[model samples]
Target: MPPGPERFVGRERELRELRADIDTPSLDALRGRPAATCRVLLVAGRPGSGRTALALRLAREQAARYPEGLLYAALTDPQGEPRAAREVAAQLLRGLGREADDDPEAALREALRERRVLLVLDDAASGEQVAPLLPHGETALVVATSRGPLAGVADVRPCTLGGLQSAACVELLAQAIGSTRVTCDPRAAETLAERCGGSPAALRLMAGWLADRPGMSVTDAVRVLPDDDATPLERAFGVVAAQLPGPAARLMRMLVLAPGALVDAHLASALAGCALEAARDALEDFARYGLLRRDPGPGAGTEPAAYRVAGWAVPLLRDALEAGERAEEVRLARARMLERTVRLVRACAASAAAPDEAATDEVPLALRFADREAASGWLRRRLPELLGAARIAVADGELDTLARRLASAAVLALDAHGQAAPERYELHGLLLEVAERRGPDRERAAALINLGDLDAAAGRTKDAVARYRAALDAARAGRDAFTLGRALEALGDSHLELGDRERAADWYGRALAQRGERGELADAARLHTRLALLHTDDGRRDAALREWRAAAAAYRRLRDHAGYAATLAEVALAQEVSGAAEESLRTGQEALRWARQADDARLQRVVLLGMARVLERLGDTEGARLQREAADGLAGPGDARDS
Candidate 1:
């Protein structure tokens, strides 16, 4: 679950009642019920009334009961528009590791059926929008926060929220500025809370108004604080907006236009076209004014504070400075930021020790890192925002070139990390959409292949094969041999995983033909190894030996000792299984030599054990014993995995 706001007060009774409701026995545990309606709890409130914060806090508190883990989905985009049910369900399916980007409602239901996951659907628009997305099981809990009533969204308990208690509101104010100011004038604090209508958001703005003007007392602020036909939140907003410094106000307006969940000093600088330090100062001002919340995560500080645009202040920012007034400035700023992201992503990808051809391009010196570890850390740290930026680019459909570049680079940087499954699904899905819409043929082919690779990793072999086949068509349309070969190789891998060795062999053969025509030693080694494995599985002795020898020769040409050793080890095993003990022993000895040269102790130990078996078969019992002893001595305590 997402972190709730700091200094949350009140809502205690509502929480208790809702907790009881969630724990209460559901009337619809069995399937074929009216969807997930009974399993849901809708928390409804007006804007700035703490609806989202309350829902998040409750979700976190109740997380442990739902062993399947908690899922948080913001039903609205950053712009506050209600996203389509299809889009929301697709993201939910992706988050659940079920990749169905198009028409994902049924898949989402299938994913949530019988799963005890807690789903927090935040900022829902109405009943019609939320109705289609409820979970299908009583064991699963759905906590939906909405500004609207969501009248028929669910047949569950409803928690209607209002302003905080006056005392709670005063305590909230005291927490922000010091207790001394409120305690210094008790009557005025009560009046201030009442005047702000006990809304946390408005009170926070008032606190900022007073905090920024330290010399002014609570009484003085109250004297000038507008009390008009406008809502208290709006009146408080009027005071803050009227007093904001030029830079801070400008930064706030552009920030709503800034894509993603964060706005750092560098991003602020880009958006405002100001110096970094100046942007930092303005961000500090925004934080103090409660226009942005200081992120409580790691690396929190003034020089590099990551501020989340306060959800309540979004409309205020738009009202203060409409996006249309300075549309070009926002566009240029976003473009500049996107360009920087492309270079940064490329540089990180290039940091891999054996970078492939596409990711080896030169970038700005500043973007380059000292080592692979540092590059990986940099890339992973910024991956979320980088991906968010790509989504925005696609939604906006303007920065096609930069968005496509970011697609490949982002996937490259993330593909190696197994824990990045969610991001991989999201990025590839977005890339596939973008590529199909307007991207060049090469990008389209690459996107399909990458998505297919993800599906293959997830054990969706049939789906992967479908995507790989599409990628082949795209690659052929572009006449790009590299992507075509890649598609063939991926298809081979998926078929192999599916236990269709014949089809796998065919795909590998096609891929090898292309690789030999256009690529290098590495591709040859890989294809030969794949073919050798397939042949070995089929018990084709001569064919397996020929492919293994070819693989070893390719590896030797490339001077890859590790690959050569592994291939030789395979050859020894095949010989041993085929009753050629003496030849097997010789091959194992050669493999052990190359394994030692490669400094791969595990590979060496494996060869030693295989040689031991060969020695025993040859009636050399003492030699077998010695080889076993050597292999055992090389094994670490934790290295008990099957060789």
Candidate 2:
């Protein structure tokens, strides 16, 4: 369930309305049978208006009615990216003690059809995301909370929440401080509440400010608060921020300029140029003072908590960051953030590809990871922050080097993790703008290559080919051999996708020759794999097998288990096609072992399915059946095959 309302104040009427909707039987249920339609209750409100708290409270109240389960899913990351629907479905399936099957949505719908589940989807980006996750059964209810009305969703009971009532605001203040303190100055309490504009978040922050000073009277508190053109929430934030010591206050301002919504102590340390311990202390103090909110760490307290600037306080903080003397400070802080972010991303990419003993010495101690999984997890959590910081750097102009490096590192990390998304393309476009304006030739080449990759992924082959050609020109101008090779390879891929076999082969051959001359084994291996695919597509099985073998050898030398496993699977398939059943089965088993060692479930499933087909061809029916079952078990709810 979402966190309980902290000193939850008014909204009795809204609560009653929510209760009535949940308690009353649906029209279909009233007709003596349940219907295949979900009842959606949308609780919409402004930021800091307590929408999440109200929705969670309603979910808690109706928990008993949903005996099968109460499932809560946050539909967006802190940076406001809408999570993929398949990922959300997997979470729901896990909560229900079920593994994700191929077709997670169908699996979830089936489960909901047989059970009474109440889903509370918080911070949804749009109605489209909510629509796919809705339970199509009368026995289930969905309470969706968003900053907007979710306007286009059909059959929703929309409740748009505003600030608290005057009396409730005072009551909330009293609860935070004490009844005695508030009642001692009832009129002053009411005045303060009015000044806060009845926003529970603002009121609570003000209450914390007052509660910190034992002898500060309510009148005095109201007197010290800012009265300006800013909104009540902003003024309230200003009032609280004023009380913080210099370090805390400065950190608060810098945080507003921090990329994305949340920050860890390591990032804070980088921004502050202070020790990690000091940054952590300042962050904790901000949380205590109600200027920040602490998010629970990953699983079972293994990690330290992360902090986010309270939503209501952000505008005021940003205002402070941009005002007069703080502008330079904000710029410097963002530069530091960009440098550190670039290093972290590079470290993650290196760690994911292959561990480097010397690389550890180069990475900051705070950014070093235990293994690939840890590095990947950190990259996933901070992707939006890294992208946001890169944009800030690009716009700022002074940090062009850091910006270029950050963009390059981010692209590498995203590629390594197979997490390329449309947002990344947008970020690459921003990088391209920066490159065209003031970046070095090498940076310009890198940006063009990254943009080309995005265009190819989006199926804009012509656009990708154009970008790659531009990249090749930049690379040649800069005399950057590595980027030259990369651009050629990318161009080859674009032409391949466009069915221009001759052009594709010419580009691939040039890229391969360049990589081989440079002793860039990884790039050479990837090129060989691509060439093998082209060969196989053209029915040149012998040539394809030769290329796959070379690629596998290079991958093994690099200790790239995932790549080697994939190449081995292709080899197995080729062997099977050539009537070498025993050799095919042997290679398939070896591929499966490597996939397991790499902990890549997708690769494991691919190998298993391939093995199953080979086994079937070899007339081993029982073995084939077992392999197919194993493959099915490893398939995720969102597997492309299911789609």
Candidate 3:
């Protein structure tokens, strides 16, 4: 047996079928057809469903019967360069040690007649390409696999493989991530199984990836895994290129050029340049043909779901889109795709914190209430397509408007989702190009601010500061005070991350002054609080207290109770640091009330600890003891903080 780690799991029924096909009928008359009658077996299954695996496994198991050897050949005919049956036969003959140059059909028949061989013709384009490869006599057993039913082969036992069972999927995960890890967390295992769609190839790929990253948890892996629909989606769309009739196929190719994953019936209608019903009919036809997967529309009764090209066919759809003669149609398709992607990004970026009912105000009506996970999923899966579209738009040069929109959309997607963000290279590269190409200084500044903030979150402090500086300059040049204030604050945060307390204080102070003049109360208050922390670090206790007091009043006026409470905690800290024992004790107690009311346990604990230290310094030993007890209670379970 092979190593258990690599051994096949699931498919006991399929294995039994293959075994029954191979076994000769017993001498008993009731046993029916003998294995000799099963000379040709066609194993049919969908792409990536393990047909190839079954064929190889069955061939290996029966190797003893065919002592000569086995031959395998691929028969799919790629477009504009179709692989012919003659070529396949000639190749199989050569694998059997015969000259391929000899008359292909004669060589195949002569070679098979000479010995006991097992032949596997994989991915046959159609039944006709497979007929010539069939054995003429019982000297050999032949197996062929295809996406669809392969007719014309008489008496061939067909074994079609479906996805693995859920249990088998779990077993595959255990093999991939090790049994101990999976068994430790059964839920993660099940989630992984469900997400893999029970496809052995996908399971094996995921497992191999997990096995290499020993410390990565199964749960974390599941969280990061792309939706099951992605690959199959590409495959389904690929067939649009191969299987659709002329104009419909052209429409599909155009659809693939779409920027984001989705293309609504209206826009798809426009791109296909057909009437609404005709376009809708084409989309439905594509769905019926499995060329695209439908995204359930909102409250539309699910009868008229929005559709996008499926995942697996993405590449094929792409090739077709790029290959067709309608250059103008392709260009327009690219423009539309960019336009939609930009719209999504703008909506997400602008309204990330919006209440659900109002979130769609800035977004497309179809996209409102679309789960963040699904939106982010589409963006991540089609990231390459998104980036490619942007680059193409840029290269077209004349479509600078489309390029700007694409660049901004890419930036927005990145802004809203961090690790799950679309590709970084495209977001930044395209933004830089668009910024240089256009004179919209404020727009350029806004894009830079987003890029800088993203860099700061990603821990690229220096790069983040550089972006912030450029944004600040652009904002100043555009006389945009709002953008300038935001940029300065971001720059301050970046410097704070680098531990440059003085420069961080200077930046925040400038931001605060500008925000104050403009009544940017919320921002100005936050900046004041940040500046106070630096003052305390430098031992300017009075200055720190004054700044915190000013910030607290600002937050209070703005009705930001949480912000006011946070400022109080900071004030309590500065007082203790400055040795104002009595004042610190009073301030901490007042801060505790606000923190607790805020319902933030983390903040409450910080205030409790501050009170304990303040009482200790004020020589109130018993009072300090009580505060320590309260702090410990708020701290909850082990304070190790070590994951």
lDDT of each: 0.78, 0.79, 0.67
lDDT of 1 by residue, 253-321 (tens): 778766655777766777778887788888887776667766533221123346778777878777776
Window of ten residues with lowest summed lDDT in model 2: 294-303
Q: Give the true-structure RMSD of model 3.
A: 21.6
Residue 371 C-alpha lDDT in model 2:
72
RMSD to the native, candidate 2? 10.0
TM-score of each: 0.69, 0.66, 0.50
Error of 1 at 163 (Å): 3.2
* Candidate 3 TM-score to native: 0.50
Deviation (Å) of 624 in candidate 1: 11
Ranking by TM-score: 1, 2, 3
Candidate 2 error regions (>4 Å): 1-5, 23-37, 59-142, 145-150, 162-171, 183-191, 194-197, 222-231, 272-275, 296-303, 324-326, 343-375, 412-433, 450-463, 480-497, 502-643
- Candidate 3 per-residue C-alpha lDDT over 1-643 given as tens digits, one digit per residue, 9 for 90 to 100: 1101234677789878877875443233235543332266777777657676677777777788888877776565322123577766755664554544435766787667757888877777677777777766566877777777767755667788878898888887886567999888889878776776676655654565466468878787676675645663243233234545676766776776554445666456546665556767777665544345455332111124566554334556666666774777677766665665566555545444546544454455644435555555445433544665687678777678878776766665656755333246346667667767874898788778877876786677899999899999999999989899999888788888998988888888888889989998888787787778788778888998999999998988997767778888888888788777788777877777877777776677777777877777777789877876777766757552211
Clashing pairs in 1: none
The prediction achieving the highest TM-score against the true structure is 1
lDDT of 2 by residue, 424-454 (tens): 7767787788878976898789878888877
